[model samples]
Target: MPTSILRIDASSRSCGSFSRDIGDVVERSLLAKHPGADITRRDLAQQQIEHIRNETIIGYYTPGEAMTDELKAVTLTSDEIIAEAKSADILLITTPMYNFSIPSALKAWIDQLVRIGRTFDYDGHSFTGLLPGKQAYVVIAYGAGGYSDDGPLAGADFAKPYLSFLLGFLGIQDVTFVPVEATTADPATVACEVEKARQNVRSSLDAG
Candidate 1:
């Protein structure tokens, strides 16, 4: 069981977000299993994160102790963001399909976590991840396309493929996808997707 959870919400909508609903279910299930689990929430809709600035990049490249005061200020936000993720045992990333991709805010958050020198190490020939031993659940909400492994638009999904790649790049191989798709279709179709997601969540928790 995860002793700490980092819940990152990328949905633009706050009230009726399907991804957030799925995250809520997952968080509740986890809480049931690990009763005092600590939850750290980063709601992108509420938190404003800018894209990686040139100054921040320079600051991040410089050693933290050696960086100047100006550079330290530039990289402080991203530093804090990385620290949060580094402390978590599980990450629940709920992202809605924004133009067939993630929201800009979520992208910014990812940029912060994928910093050089902090989350990875280059051994000349290749790189090794510094953040491992954690699991991730990606809950993607879509209006029409069903992008699961067996869905008709299976190979058409760029979100899941990209997210999986990002996780692997960070040495996070134990990842699960909970897709809630075809929301603009009939009620039956949406319900079917929700049921499938619920089942997947249960199975994931059980297997873990």
Candidate 2:
């Protein structure tokens, strides 16, 4: 079946963002596999997201007219974000690791998408992720050396784990990570790693 892929690029940098570049390569492969697939792109650098505030939280719980204008602008984007996410069969998140974690703008987007009783719900006993039938692919780029889920840097680095947690929280169990590590390594090494990631994406596309 044809799929709709939502491509979100969270890199603040210019075209030099290796993560975005790898994501483009993977998207191209996906398009090749599913010729009728539709792609929607969102550049977080171009359209920045406002941080969630106390007013925003209050607005989220209050009535429409009761919310101040500023609070409405801050907290009322959940419907739009949720609608877009719900429409997509696949989500492609491309983000460079900034200070060992996701960009603030991306986090803001996440906060908006994760509305209580919407994306997930917490009963008296436990939390339940409401979003289902969604798959996610994360492309992560880092300037330092390799950092996997099991290493000295594992707990310290919040990029991969945070992405995994967020997607998993949304009930997206079919999630994959394509990490293009050591971008700050030697030029040759970086180039080789990029090629490897591109190849991995190609293989994934072919398999799918």
Predicted candidate 2 versus true structure: per-residue lDDT over 1-208, tens digit per residue: 5799998899998678999898988888778877899888778899886777787677667776676778767666766787778889999999989998999989988988887767888888987887888988899998876587475666667898888988988889888899888898999999898888888887777677
Model 1: how large is the Cα RMSD against the reference?
1.7
Give the range of the ten consecutive residues with the poorest summed lDDT in model 1.
145-154
TM-score of candidate 2 to 2 decimals: 0.90
Worst 10 residues of 2 by lDDT: 145-154
lDDT of 1 by residue, 1-208 (tens): 5499999999889998899998888888888878899999999999878888889889878976799999988888888999998999998899987777788888999988898888988878998878899989899998876576677877777788888998888888899888888877788888898888899889888556
Cand. 1 TM to true fold:
0.94
Off by over 4 Å in 1: none
